[model samples]
Target: MSAVVLSVALSASASADMFKPSKAEQMKLGKQAAAEVRKKEKVLPDSDPRVQLVKRVGRRILSTFSEKEQPWEYSFDVIESKEVNAFALPGGPVFFYTGLLEKFKYEDELAAVMAHEITHVRREHWAYSQRDANKANVLLLGLSLFGGRRDVLSATDLLATFYSLKYSRQHENQADSMGFDMLVAANYNPDGMVLLFETLKQSSKGGKPPEFLSSHPDDGNRIRNAKTKIEKSPKEFPALTKINL
Candidate 1:
């Protein structure tokens, strides 16, 4: 029985290896999907002063953290919505909601949030996730073709869903860490990261939590992590010098 189990495990591992997609293929597919999503999404104008400010700050922070010699163009825009959310897609597409900007008490806090989202792109976290999803689908297809088992295909689909969700959470944590480092390197106040989380926690108290809050992990956990990092390496806050707002 032990030998049989070992043989089954080896087979599964080999199948998994065969399913993995190349990074180039994943990038092509991800860019195509992103283009479709962008068409449906409304992006704020670059001419807007607030939008420009975000870009300026984002560039500064990103320049410090990103070592990749490639030309990474960063675009920051304020979506015309009240949702307290910000997201960065693969290839440096970033959107920040007006509500999130209103919640920031300090510029550093805003920068911290921007840095966190930007890290998602810089680290290619989304690309990796997309690659993994494609790989899973490939594996499912192979199983259906070779094993001729409908059950295997169903199981693979379910596993892919779970894996996607799990990968999202992992990506969030990684961005958080990268953001912390980026903010510190740029000489921005790291406490701003904690403050942003505190704002989110407070916002969730009375009314229904926003979609962003629901999608992200607990604000308390994020705040705690930010605070711990801040205490270790505190940086002076920059003066409010002609903010675009």
Candidate 2:
């Protein structure tokens, strides 16, 4: 009856494509995207306190990945921006915005954010999205060439579709569930994910919404979903603990 369960019932169809991008391909695409981001955003130094804390949380999360689930290489970066946003690229590139980092006083909350982003990579959402786009374009191109159909959806439509892709609600919920499991497995507080969602909801009240909330929506349902997941997780978590950065 939960929203997460309902979402899974509706959207958890197995993808039909069997030829997803390989790890090398994902790493190549990630490196390219990361370089473009680096050219525009100022990268924080290794010694910056916020950067250090993010890296620590990132590594801890990375350590919890199962062997077969390990990404090619994990590299976390702090971007110098005031907008509250963060994201992970296809392979292992993760970025955090300074505006977001300054708001967190504990590593658990930070871990929540990083774990969510990491789930996107581990789940191969980006590569699958790209694969879908490519298939559509190829089919459109073929129809134009062979079937003499030029009035099909335009390239602009394809671009719009790609950019406008909000990860399905099911994937978002799965990320929350997996991130909760990772927190419990690694001895971090699962409540941080819920706390992060609450903080995002609060910050969006008086002003513009944080950029993080744009792609990763934080409706109350997701918070409740995380709470349910924590309560039911099979991991034998010890007494929940909190740590200051």
Candidate 3:
């Protein structure tokens, strides 16, 4: 399908998924998962400037969606840890770590990051991935029972892991595309998505990849895809003045 058609399809049915968890269930799961994260990690107070900054950007993105467009109860929080990481739960909860937050040099760049994570939730990526992985595991279980070989089970388990990771990478790409549309619709710089991936690529040089990249598409491919969208959709995504970080 053409990019324009795909974009329209995504906008029209952002929550459509073949997964088991319904939107209400996703919301409940997100709330429970968020609570567990808060208990295990040191979440910065809402009063903190960092937390407020993230919320400010998050609110701008949320404003682009009408009540009917967004069924999830969106919330944003910052963690105290130094890991270069951010993630969204099943529904609308998004978390940013200090290390990753500090790397952002502009508001649009931060918006790029937040929008990508939020799209994962809006797209029900976790629920879809979990359901698919569970199915694969069940098959593996059946194989183990019939064959009764530890080595076969272990190999199948590894194959399942590989499939799960590959599926996650596909989700990462989807989130990138949807999030780029969102960033522009929210009147943030369309280039922010490309800029963010370029920065990530630079950071991953000559070292272990950031935890953030573990399940994401290759940075180079993401950057290129974002640029293509920007170039192809100038009318739909008008350029905006970028705010400094």
Candidate 4:
């Protein structure tokens, strides 16, 4: 694949109760975290085929954004782990585990995963989550000091837990929606997203579920949602194709 400059503009959206960090701050923190991960985790070398494929798809998906919109210096790395998981840090450090990569049989499938992770960073979900968690902690502490009752504290904990789960589910769905658009915008087949979900569902049949699925939307719901989007916007997507590295 020809090299493309993949970048995204920093989001300036406002939040009612969240303390959003500056893009520079996020990048710095992400770099620190990524460095620590590299030090402790067994990262695959660039020469590894898996790493190369990840970078290739990642760059393609990122190319959908303009170069002038550069806000995060995104980097992709592969981890030598058996757990089927992938994640992106605050600014732009994305990691893929070998187990997750092994499940991907096509480049488009890989692109779907990469695009979803990229959306998380682009939307600043982690920063928002952290701020929300901080608020919950403060609220809980205030309740503890004022209420001084076990039942009151339990109720607050239950509410906080509910809100966290709801917010997380919302984020996961948003990532899926945005990532599907990015996949198509990058010229990969949009069906790749739905197929990727199907693969995950199949993988979870008779054994422990993938770590990737732990925080994500239910597989059935995700697949149905993707299909609904494609059905709603048939003209927006190109003909389906199987893209292999």
**Tens-digit lDDT track of model 2 for 95-210:** 99988887775677788888888888888877676656544554444222225232243334433453345676666767777777777666887777777888888877766665
Clashes within 3 Å, all models in order: 0, 0, 0, 0
TM-score of 3: 0.76
Better of 1 and 2 by lDDT: 2
Extract clashing residue pairs from model 1: none
Superposed model 2: Cα runs more than 4 Å off: 1-19, 143-165, 206-212, 233-245
The collision pairs in model 2 are: none
By lDDT: ranked, best first: 4, 3, 2, 1
**Cα lDDT for residue 70, candidate 2:** 55
Please, what are the lDDT tens digits per residue for candidate 4 over residues 118-228?
A: 988899887677556544554444322124232232223332442233338878888889998898789887788887888887877776665346676364888888888
Q: Which pairs clash in model 4?
A: none
Instruction: Encode model 3's per-residue lDDT on 1-245: one tens digit a residue.
Output: 45654454445334444224567767776787678778878999988988999999999998898678768888899999877778787778888988888777778888998888888888887668756654445344332212433223222333234223433677878888889888888888877777778777777777545544666636477777888888888565445444444
- The segments of candidate 1 whose C-alpha lies over 4 angstroms from its true place after superposition are 1-38, 66-72, 139-167, 205-216, 234-244
TM-score of every candidate relative to the true structure: 0.70, 0.77, 0.76, 0.77
Clashes of 1: 0
List runs of model 3 lying over 4 Å from the truth: 1-19, 142-167, 216-219, 236-245
RMSD of each: 6.1, 8.5, 10.2, 12.0
Residue-level lDDT tens digits of model 1 in 54-154: 88888788677536534445666677667677766456657787777777767787888888877776676755664565445544444232363322323
